[model samples]
Target: MQYVPFTPYRRVLTLPRVRPSMALMFFARLPMTMTGVTLTLYVVSNLGHGYGAAGIVGAASTLGMALGAPLLGRSIDRYGLRPVVGVCGVTSTAFWIAVPHLSYAVLVVCALPAGFLSVPAGSLARQILAALVPAEQRRAAYSLDTILVEASFMIGPAAGIAAITSLSATVTLSGIGAIFGVTALLIFLLNPPIRNEDELAPIGSVRPPLRSWLSGRLLATLLVAAGTLFCLVGTEVATLAALRANGDVGWTGLVIVVMCAASMAGGIVHGAVKRSLPQGVLMLLLAVLVLPVGLADQPWWLLMLVLIPTNLLCAPTLAATTETVSTMAPPAVRGEAMGLQDASTRLGLALGSPVVGFAIDHSSPAWGFFAAGAGGLVLAAFGLLWTRRRRPAAVAPALAAAVRARR
Candidate 1:
């Protein structure tokens, strides 16, 4: 139960600076879910356009994220997280204000760059937590940060939906821009943990993780997990339609609430337990746990109950994978690794949407859940194979004897 030094709790919560910085993250992400959802709605609902146009607009932002992350991660590694975060925050704010005016063509182009520029607050927050808090306590710090993120995302969409309905999406969008602009600036001015000079090596060096990332086994393992994440998120979106059709009017929001609440609890526990399980074993365990949600049915109570187990597997596995990736990545190219992690996540969501949407369209909601669950099993199987492959080869008896004799 020993906590790392500099952690808020390790310092007995006496560190106002640490507490405030963490609090800022809550505000930092509050608009994250809202911006894209509301922006898309605003385009279609207010501007009188089809879903295609909205989709294009949304895709533009993802493009930005795909392009921007590595550069920013590199910058954070080189200069510092604060300055990079601040720049991204300001850029995001400016882009938000102008997003509405751009035509569909212009919007798509803008979105790619913007997505790239958008400060990956989640990743940046982790970096700061690592720097400010002692290494051992960092797991707790990340757990707490994940909790804040879970809460923020849960609240953000509802708020965005409400704002668009009450005040108009355009106004809401503008307000969000201002709120974040100030938030990013304030975090910058406060000089959060990202400013710590001693931690420069992780953020600064530009070396590559050639050996680890290129290793066949490790890359395969990451991609498999990435696919599972994609399916899970896509299933969430598809489930809303299923609920409405099933006459469970209120279940849509409830499902999300259940998943996130369960994930938050899971993250807390994962942080508490000091299990030293290898990454591959942990992956398969989590994968198997989520594989049954595909069969959920009518008992309202049963829906909630099943979600607890599935949701529990979500955060910790992802966090574990991320921690593993960081460990394997070299300093020079750590940013690339972080960016790839994010891009992989985004890719999952992106790929999952079409497949889930099609399943729901062609068959039923059950199909979407089925795909998700089965996809998880596929990942689990891949993990098993990957682990096997990663194991060292058997040594030849005569050659082994010669090598040992030399030793």
Candidate 2:
């Protein structure tokens, strides 16, 4: 195992952000979540686009993310977070203002660049957390970030959907756009230097292509992990909608809210762990317990109960994965590593929806949960074996031992 470098960081995670970098992140996400799912709804329902056309636009958003993430991260690595985030916010705002009127074709074109440049608020937040926390404690830092993002997802879409349905999609788009504008301003006004910049070499005459950072086994593994998580997101939400359990559209969001709340609560509790546990054990437990998520019937009252223990471990699992990525990637390529992680999750969501939706259409809506849980189990097992194989023989035993302990 490679030793993770430690930096002297203290508790901003424990206290309020004096500069409130997280606030900037919260606002920046308003458009990202809204655009990906809710805004797609607006295009199909309000705008003159077929549902199939919405799929194309969604693909464009993924394409934009895949194309843009590494580039944006590299820019942050080279120039600074301030400039890239500012540019992203500006372009995203402009895209929103245009979203209401643009032809499906135009929206597709715009989504590519817009999604790409939109300040990777999530990655930026993680970067800040990485710099702010001591390396040993980075797991908790990432858990906190994940909790915040889960909260954001819970709230952002509800607000966006309500704004679009009652007021107008245009109004919502403008509102979200304005939020991004504010985000740009906040990031610039704060102008906090990222501590991780030292990890990257000074951008000299030549910049490497996005592929250099992403086209590697390490990046591929991290992306796979991230993609799996978002697949859970997609599958869970779609199944809830298909079942129409509990109540109405609001209920669908509420169901997800329950799950997100569980995740956030889990993160809080997980952060308090002083003793290290075997990761594979926790992951397998989570995977097995989560198998029941697929069986949630109308009014999934028991789902929360089932996830109480399972949920606590989820964020930490992912956070640990993030830490691993950070440790594995050279500093010069850190941004690309993060970008791939982000892009993978985004594309995974887009991809997962169709696959799970198909299951709901044919087999049963409940299958989504089982698939996610089962899929997670398979992947976690893969991760453990993969990690062991990648390690030298001596290190492999420790990893295998950890896996055994987890199982």
Give a tens-digit lDDT track for model 1, residues 373-399.
556566557756765676554235557
lDDT of 2 by residue, 31-115 (tens): 6676666667887898767777888887777778767887787777777777787788788778888788787767777887776
Off by over 4 Å in 1: 1-17, 194-221, 276-286, 379-384, 393-407
Residue 22, candidate 2: alpha-carbon lDDT:
63
Candidate 2 ranges with C-alpha deviation above 4 Å? 1-10, 14-19, 196-217, 220-224, 245-250, 276-284, 307-310, 393-407
**Model 2 alpha-carbon miss at residue 337, Å:** 1.8
Instruction: State residue 20's C-alpha deviation in candidate 2, in Å.
Output: 2.0
Best by TM-score: 1
Model 1: lDDT of residue 58: 79
- Write down the TM-score of every candidate: 0.84, 0.82
